[model samples]
Target: MNQLFRLPQVGEADAIAEPSADLRVPFAQSGTFVCKFIIGEPSDQAVCCGAPVADGKSWCAYHRRIVFEPARPGRAR
Candidate 1:
């Protein structure tokens, strides 16, 4: 089988890199310009990537690619 992407398994979300202090923002501070990707545990302490989002996108280029990865060609099926 040919795989174009590998989705992270459950409980692996916490492996996300620690967001830099300057690039982290509380959920309430997120907006069109801030990456909407949530990081950290779901709680008042959680933050979103405050990195500048890609043009016209709610997430930064990195996160966008993770969420919208292209599907693998299915000819192998």
Candidate 2:
């Protein structure tokens, strides 16, 4: 059973070090739009989900759904 759930391979660590370019949103001059997800060692880096956000919210559409949406009754997560 343990074989069904395996840890990430050694080389896989590097792949997760940086977010994909496609997922990053272009920074605006005023810097009004910024992702609430923080990255980096000191936790200073922020993610840009490449999309607009709803009013009165900090995270982008993707993050908002993951962070705020309620889990389904039969879902594992």
Q: Which candidate number has the best TM-score?
A: 1
Which digits, one per residue and each the tens of the lDDT, describe model 1 over residues 30-55? 76777878876778777887887558
lDDT of each: 0.69, 0.45
The local distance difference test score of model 2 is 0.45
The parts of candidate 1 lying over 4 Å away from their true place are: 1-21, 75-77
Q: Write down the TM-score of every candidate.
A: 0.57, 0.35
Q: Give the alpha carbon lDDT tens digit for every residue of 1-77 in model 2.
A: 12232246433533433334565643332145555443333322444454444474666545654566543334553
Model 2 lDDT-worst window of ten: 1-10
Q: lDDT of model 2 at residue 4?
A: 32
TM-score of candidate 1 on Cα atoms, chains taken together = 0.57
lDDT of 1: 0.69
Clashes by residue pair, model 2: none
